[model samples]
Target: MTVGPKARRSGLPARDRRVTTRRVREDQRERSVRADVPTGGGDVGVATDAEAARVQEREALRLAHRVVDLAEDRKASDIVLLAVAGMTTLTDYFVICSGGSERQLGAIAEGISEGLKQDGYLPIGREGSPDAHWLLLDFGAVIVHVMAWPERDYYGLEKLWSEAPLLLRIQ
Candidate 1:
């Protein structure tokens, strides 16, 4: 088969040429859309989503540590801080701790919630009952899990997120 000079030079069939042109146009359109969207950095012109996410993750980890401190102060046991930012998109950090009893678990949860609240941060949602074996506090970028010793042992959150790096652990 004989090919024309232009077709031979371009090295693509007519159908492929059309598809390539369309793909280029689509890419241009996507770049335009991304150009208009503001990065979450607040007043810093433009940044990649990954950059913004890193900033958020740092802040979330800081808050997670604070929660750990509060729980420890309240005498929560076996506190663990997991850096889940690289493992999951759910939250940047998971502050998991065990309390000896339901009452102690409730006290730990309340201490963390109120302590962060005093810092002008409020949980987005709270689940599990304070009277139950497990209490979860969701703070958008961070999640706190206060569980009874038996619940913590049964759930094994640390094992579940075993791949996540352990940022802090207090026995």
Candidate 2:
């Protein structure tokens, strides 16, 4: 029946009346609740660790597809996209493509890099030279291999990582 500040002071035990650390924490938790916060179930604002990882994986897959499209634009031949997340810890996706000649290889590499950079993606590292006839552009989650027909056939990356699923191929 009594419910004012003075009435609230009338308590049973000293232990119940005093504001302990645990009691203060409980009071803060109660006060922090708002319409935006869930009272019981469901999460809000931030994603869980597993969900975040899956989101990152989806981003990597998207990037891989973008690379494929860019390579196709530049007339790359024998394009193959491989999902290597389960097979390798190095990268999530592998984009293997072949060009007719060394000059074509460089164009494929440049086209992929410039196109991705425009969309806010950059290569972490680049490997091989024009003379080598093999170019590798590493973009963190996704890696691109630009090779001449002979080298691509010689290495046989698709055969090497045979366990990985082939997401796409344009021959």
- Using lDDT as the measure, the top candidate is 2
In model 1, where do residues sit more than 4 Å from their true spots? 1-51
What TM-score, over all chains together, does every model reach? 0.70, 0.74
Model 2 lDDT per residue over 1-171, tens place = 123355455563444545443464344223223223322367554555555565577778888999999999999998999999898777889999999887888999999999999997767668897579899988777889999988888999999999999999999
Measured on C-alpha atoms, candidate 1 has an lDDT of: 0.78
Error of model 1, residue 41, in angstroms: 17
Candidate 1 lDDT tens digits, 1-171: 123455555688877766776665444223323232354555645546665455555566678888989999999999999888778767778999988888888899999999999987767667888677999988766799999888888989999999999989999
Runs of candidate 2 with Cα error greater than 4 angstroms are 1-44
Distance from true position, residue 87, model 2, in Å?
0.9
Worst 10 residues of 2 by lDDT: 30-39
RMSD of each: 17.0, 20.0
Q: Looking at candidate 1, what is the lDDT of residue 93? A: 89
Candidate 1 lDDT score at position 22: 60
Candidate 2 versus truth, CA RMSD in Å, comes to 20.0
